[model samples]
Target: MNQLKLTVSILATAGLLFFIAACAQMGTLPSLPASHPEALAIGQQVNCAECHEDQQKGTLKPYKAFNHSPVFVKSHRFYAASDDRLCSTCHKSSFCNDCHTNKVQIKPSTKFGNRPDREMQHRGNFMTMHKIEGKLDPASCYRCHGRANNERCIQCHR
Candidate 1:
């Protein structure tokens, strides 16, 4: 009975810790900046720099910055895709082409190689292990090679 009680207590503690970590990761978002609402209300263009307090590294951080807010990461894709020139305001066309283009692709890995501590995609052994990974996550492959005539995919898949 005592052992079972200890086990249950340990599990309960672990569950609570997990819940706290998840809450931290799913950051609490404050209300949208006054500019967003005011811009929409008055039919004016929204300027992000107005609300963002600082620019660090490359990311434009909002006034109440918390490194990387989960809310922003989840919704940024929607904001980027809906506009034609919105991204150019903050990001170069080359930034979009890095992931979206079918041409001689420059891997994010190359850019991030200088910072070895940062989390990176397609690790050292990826080239050798990619076939199994591709089979498991075909959707990832399609992101870069969605074209029906993708020569890159054809080189291996065909």
Candidate 2:
């Protein structure tokens, strides 16, 4: 009788461990896409709430308020517009060229427009070589990385 009880207890313990492991694995899994059409469409809509749900709800909020701030508008600009051109509006070539030219290194050999390498007279755009080894630079990232962060590239690209 004692042996049977011990065996049952062992089985129960093993089952509990397996259940916990499964739960942990599930948490690590990527979230599935929205099932409903409306939900998927809503996902495309750029809003402060979309990225910063906690901040919007006033629970575990990162930023103080979402109003009357340049960051808020900046976040919306990239999300709603879905293009780098919006960024170029305020951050003119002069601003970018200052940092990119001075701090960052560029390769002049790379050709941008039509006409292959040294084929005909064409504009040669310098290529910036900033390697993203593993992690991102916190300082450089803060420009767009706001309270609510979305990893989906398609959200903005598409």
Best by lDDT: 1
Tell me the tens digit of each residue's lDDT in model 1 across 9-111.
9999999999999889766534333233332222223344455546434233343433123564434555566543434544467755655566544456676
lDDT (C-alpha, whole model) for all candidates: 0.56, 0.40
The CA lDDT at 79 in model 1 is 55
- List TM-score per model, in order: 0.45, 0.22
- Candidate 1's C-alpha lDDT? 0.56
Candidate 2 per-residue C-alpha lDDT over 1-158 given as tens digits, one digit per residue, 9 for 90 to 100: 99999999999999999999999888656532233123223212234355546553213233234332446544543433543343343335554332233332222223223323322211232112223411356454333333324433235535
State the displacement of the C-alpha of residue 138, model 1, in Å, after optimal TM-score superposition.
2.0
Q: Which candidate is the best by TM-score?
A: 1
Regions of model 1 farther than 4 Å from truth: 1-76, 115-120
* Alpha-carbon shift of residue 35 in model 2 (angstroms): 2.7
lDDT of 2: 0.40
